[model samples]
Target chain A: MSGRPIFTRPARLAAIVPYVWMLLLFLVPFGFVLKISLSQSALSQPPYLPTFAIAMDDAAWRAALGLLSVDSFRLLLTDNLYVLSYLRSLVVALVSTALLLAIGYPIAYGMARLPLRWQPVAMMLVIVPFWTSFLIRIYAWITILQHDGLLNQVLLALRIVAEPVVWLSTDSAMYLGMIYSYLPFMILPLYATLSKMDPALLEAANDLGASPRRAFWSITLPLSLPGVAAGWLLCFIPITGEFVIPDLLAGSESSMIGQTLWLEFFTNKDWPVASAIAIVLLLVLLTPLAIYNRLQRRQLEAR
Target chain B: MRANRLSPFNIICLTLGAAFLYLPIVILVIYSFNASRLVTVWGGWSLRWYQDLFNDSAMLAAAWMSLRVGVASATLATLLGTLAAVALARGEGFRGRGAFSGMLYAPLVMPEVITGLSLLLLFVAVNAERGFWTVTAAHTTLTMCFVAVAVQSRLSALDRGLEEAAMDLGCTPTRAFIAVTLTLIWPAIAAGWMLAFTLSLDDVVIASFATGPGSATLPIRIYSEVRLGVKPQINAVCTLIIALITVLIVTASLVSKLSRARGESAAPL
Candidate 1:
C-alpha cells in the first residue's frame, strides 16, 4: 500500500500536522480552563492562584487535587441569581429554537415547493441578510424597538396604542431579536433536506385522497426530522450562550449565562468563578453533543 | 408532482419572511444618509455621517486591524483546514480518526463564550501576552473548523478515480494530489477562505476575550457605542461594510454560475 515511501511519509506527516495544531491550540486550551476552574482567584496580575501550577507548591497541589473548597461551584448552585440565570438562558434558547422552527418551516417548505427556476432566488433571499454584520443587525433592532422608534411611531399614527409600549428591554424583544438573527440558520438546513425529497411521495399521498395538510404531516414532516434536529441543535447551542442579543435588547435584567460569565470576569474580576461557570457550561452541553455524535454515526452506518 | 404550485398560504409566508429579513437592513442603510442626529427621524438626505466615518481615526485604525487580522487568520485557517480535509476525505483509514473528527466539529457547535474564555485562560496559562497574535490564533482555531468542513465536502464528492489514474501514469502520490486533486478543489478552498475572512470580521465575543490592549475590532467598537444609542455614523459604516460584502457575494455567485455554465464539476458550496 505504501510502495512510494517518499510520498506516503510526507502525506502522513502533513495530515498529522493539523491534528497536532488542534491538540495544542484547541484541546489544550480547554484543559487550562478546566484547571483554572479548580483554582482560586487572586489579586495579582494574571488573576488566578498558584497560577494553574499543580506540582509547584503544597497549596497548588491541594488545589489541583480537588481539595480546594468547592466555594465557586457552591456559589453557582446556592446563589439564586446564578442558578436562575442558567435556567433562564436554557429556557430562552429552547423557546427561541422552537420559535425559529415555527417561523422557518413554512418559509423553507415554500421554497422547497417552488419550481426549480425559482428555488435558487428564494434561497439567496434567505442568505443575503445573513451576510450583514450581526452587531449591526442587532443595532437595527434597537432603532426599531426604542420608545420613539419606527414601530411606536407607526402604531401611534394608526391608533394602535395611545403611548409607545416599551419594546426594547423586554423578554419579547429579546425573543424577537433571537428569531431575527437565527432564522436563517434554522431555515437553511430544513431547506436542504426538504428540497431533496422526491415530489412523487407527496403526489402519491395527494392522489390517494389525502388533503395537502395531511400529506404534509404524514409524508413531509416526518421526513424532515433530521433537518429540523440539525437546525434546532445549531440554533439552541449558540443561542444559549448568546451575548450580544441579550446585552443589547434584553439588558442586564435578562440573566443569560454568557452575560453572567462576562460579569464574573470583568465586573467582579472573579476569574475563578468565571472559569467554574465555563466548566459547568461545557459539562451541561456534553450530553447533547455526545447524542448528536451518536446519531451521526448511526446515520453514516445506515448509509 | 411535476407541476407543483405554491398555494396562497405559502406565498404569504414567503413574502412576510422576506420582508422581516430585509426591512431592518433597508432601514439601517437608508438612515445612514439622514441629516438629523436622531436615529428614527427621517432627516433630509446628507452625506455628513459618511464623511465623519472616513475622518474618525479610531475607527480607521480598528478597520485596518480587523482587515489585516481577517486576512492573516483566514489564510492560516484555509491552509490548515485543507490539510485536515485532505486527511479526512482522502485517507482510506487512519488511527484516531473518530476523535480527530470530533475535535474538529466541537468548535462548530460550542458556545462562543466558552471558546473565548477557554482561549483566554490558555493564553494566561502559557504566559503568552495577549495581543494581535492572540486574537489571530483564537480566530484561526474558530474558523479552521468551518473551512475544513467546506473543503472536506468538496473533496468527498470529487471523483476518486482521477487521483488513481494519475498515479497509474507513473506520477507519485504527492504529485498526483498537487496536479489533479488540488486544482479541482481550489474553488471550494477560495470559498472557504472568504467565509472564514467574513467570520473573523464579524466576530466580537471571541475578540473581546482573546484580545488585549488596543485590539478592539470594528464590532467591538460599534457595540460599545451602540450601547449609548444608535448613531448615524455607525449606520454609515454598517452600510459600507454591507456594500463590500454584497460585492464579494455577487462576485462569488457569478464565478460559481459561470463555472457551472462551463460544465465544470465543482459542487455548489
Candidate 2:
C-alpha cells in the first residue's frame, strides 16, 4: 500500500494554521469592536465600561450582557452631527464613484486598444502611482491646490483667471483628490475586462455597418458591466469611509463619518461612539460587498 | 482592426488621463529640489530639503521603525498568505471553506477605520501592549489578505499536471509541491511580498489607530507633519520614496524580461 492519505498530515496542518490565525486576529476583533460598541463611554483605562470576561460564569455573563446598552447607536440617530455626516459620506461616495466611472472608462478603453507591447507599459504606469505613498500623494495636492500654487500660477499666466483661485480647502479640490487617488482602482479592473474582449466581435460589428458609438453602446458597454460593478464597489466602499482626502483637502466644515470617528476616538476619547460609527459603516457597506462577492464566486465557478 | 487601431478620441483620452494621473506627483518631485523656502517659487534646483531630511532625527527614527515593521510584517504575511492560497486552491471540500474565503476577502473591502478600530479594541480587551508589535500584527493581518489574493490567482492559473507528475515519480505530496508548485508560483509569492511591504510602508490610518505613543511609523509621522502643513522636508522624503520604488520596479521588469529571453533561447537547445 502506498499509505498516502488524500489529506496529508502536513497539508491539513498548513490549512489549519492560516484558518486559526485568521479566526483569532481577523474575525475575533470584530466581535470585540461589536462588544465595545454596545458599552458606555467612560473615564477608564480602556475607555469603556462593562467589559466582558470569557471566564465569567453563565450568570455573570448574563449580567454583563444586561449592562450592555445601545445608547451609542441611539446617539448616532439623535445627533445631527452623526446623522448628517453619514449622509454627507454617502453622498460623497456616490458622486466620487460616478465621477470615477466616467473618467476611468475612456482611459481603460484606450489602454485595451493599445498594441500588445504597450499594454503592459500602460498598466505599469497606472500601478506605479498606486505603489507610491498614499499620504504623500494626498499631500502633493495641497501643494498644487494652494491659493498661490502651480495650478493658480498656470491659470493666471494663461489669463484663465484674474487672480489666484482659492482651490485648497474647497470641495472642488477634495473631489479632485478623491478622483485622482481612486482612479487607478477604477481603471485597473475596467482594463482587465476590456482587454479580454475579442477583436473579432468589433470587426463583425464594423462589417455589419454599425457605427462605433452604436457598437460601444450595444456591445462594449454591456460586456463591461461586470468590470463597472467591480470598479464601483472598489471605489465606493472605501470612499464612504475615507478619512484622508476629506481631512486633508476638504474644508473644515465638511466632516465625513471617518473624520467623525477619528475625532471621537482620538480627540474626545469616546470609544463607544467611534465603535458605533464603525459598526454602522460596516452595515452600510455589507449589501454592495455581498453583491460583489456573489459576482466573484460566479465568475470563479464559471472558470 | 478598427477597434485595435487608436483613434484621435482614444489618444486624447489617454493623454489627458495620463496627465491627470501623473502631473501632481511630477510637480511635487520638481518642487522637492526648490532652494527657496516658499514651495511655489521654483528656487532653481537645489537639494536643500533633501539635506534637511537627513538631519531630522524624529523622521529618521520613524523611517527606521517603518522599515523594521515593513520587513517583519511582509515576511509574516507572505508565509501565511502563501499557505492560505495553496489551501484554498488545492484543498477541495474542506470544512468551512466558504467561511475561510469570506474571511480572506472581507478585509479587502472593509474600511481601514473599521479594521483599525476593531483591532485596537481587541488588543485593549486582551491587555496586550499597543506598540510596535501590535502595529506589526495589524499590518500583517490586513496585508496578508492582499498577498493571498495575488498568490491565489497565480495558483489557480498554474497547471496541476506538473505537480501530479512529480508525485507519480515517487515524490511525496510535500516534495511534489516544493519541487513543482512552489517553484512555479515563486514569482507570485515574491510579488505578493513586495505588495505587502509597500502596503505596510504606505499605511497611515491603520498604523495611526494601532500605534502607541512611541511607535509611530514613517507614514504616521508624515501625516502628522502634513496636518500642520506641507513641509519641504516631507516633500523630499516623498520624492526619495517615489524614486526608490521606480528604480526597484524598473530593475525587476528588466531582470524578468532578460530571464525570459534567456529561458526562450535555452529551451531550443
Give the top-scoring candidate (lDDT). Answer: 2
- What CAPRI-style quality would you assign to candidate 2? medium
| Model 1: CA > 4 A from native | A1-12, A52-67, A295-303, B1-3, B262-269
lDDT of candidate 1 over B63-135, digit per residue (tens): 9888988999999999999988877776545688787778787788788999999899888878888878999
lDDT of 2 by residue, A1-303 (tens): 122355345555677878988999988988988888899988988888887777889998888788899999999999899999999999999999999999999999999988888898899989988888788889898998888888899999999999888988888888999999999999999999999888788878989999989999998999999999999998898899999899999999869999999999999999999999999999999998788777665655454
TM-score of each: 0.94, 0.96
**Local lDDT at B41 for model 1:** 94
Model 1: per-residue Cα lDDT over A82-159, one tens digit each:
889889989999999999999999999888888888888999999877777788888888889999999999999999
Q: For candidate 1, what is the lDDT?
A: 0.84
Segments of candidate 2 deviating more than 4 angstroms: A1-13, A54-63, B1-3, B258-269
RMSD of each: 3.1, 2.5
TM-score of chain B of each: 0.93, 0.94
lDDT of each: 0.84, 0.87
For candidate 1, give the DockQ.
0.57
